[model samples]
Target: MQAYDAQTLVLCALADGPLHGYAVNTAIERLVGTRLGPGSLYGALSRLEAKQLIEPADDAGAQPRQRPVRLTPTGRQVLERELRSMAKVAAAGLASLKVNPA
Candidate 1:
């Protein structure tokens, strides 16, 4: 749960369902204001797959298509753990802000 790039998180979020890279890129932009290019997108995906955070899914798109992706149970566990850690961090930050008023 160390700080991960926003697109990485966005990718994990979309693993709730299979999605193409374009859909993932748009979601990343919408969710985190990051403009993800092809190299960056696939690089992240490759690393994530290596880490077992996501896996390839079948693509049914009609074009020069790309593989869709979805989360494994391991991925879901990792996401949940990261989210809980983020919540704890946010809570601590909020507490500090309240105490210091800065």
Candidate 2:
């Protein structure tokens, strides 16, 4: 699995459903406790779009830049796989530290 930062966050934000840029940021903030600036959000969006991980949705009232986006099937699969990998790493780290299971 590839190491991801904002990209993973972005993907995780969209995992629940479709969201426009602003909404995506909101979701990300709620999830990660930080807001992505416009530049960072859009940059991650562009890369995700280019990778075919996400696509615009049929949001008629939205402007081009505000159009909602949903993860593609491939995107969901990739995100799920990545999450599983992350879970494994987290488990290992916790175990190594002798952290009690929640």
Candidate 3:
């Protein structure tokens, strides 16, 4: 997947709650039918953290090596906006092709 797509997937993965690296990728895999590689996953996490879109969760019971993360409020807003934008694009593309979605 493209860089932005990976980042967006990361954001979507954290939408419901916090997750560590592995769980995040597992969720993504369930959604997309493929898991991201280590570099892609961690890189997207790092980028999202840098952008203040995601942050370490307050999971006191989490393992020392596993840092769970959740989306910030801004992240939620961004995700909603992105999803809407993608929906619009998809609708336009399908309409242009005269294809009715099931």
Per-model clash counts, in order, read 0, 0, 0
Error of 2 at 76 (Å): 0.1
Error of 1 at 83 (Å): 1.1
Candidate 3 residue-wise lDDT at 79: 92
lDDT of 3 by residue, 1-102 (tens): 443499999999999999999999999989898999999999999999899999889986777338899999999999999999998998999999999955
Candidate 3 off by > 4 Å:
1-4, 60-65
1 against 2, candidate with superior lDDT: 2
Using TM-score as the yardstick, the better of models 1 and 2 is 2
**What overall lDDT goes with each candidate model?**
0.70, 0.88, 0.89
Rank candidates by lDDT, best first. 3, 2, 1
Which candidate do you rate higher for lDDT, 2 or 3?
3
Model 2 misplaced regions, further than 4 Å: 1-4
Model 3 residue 81 lDDT score? 98
Model 1, stretches more than 4 Å misplaced? 1-7, 60-65, 99-102
For candidate 3, the lDDT comes to 0.89
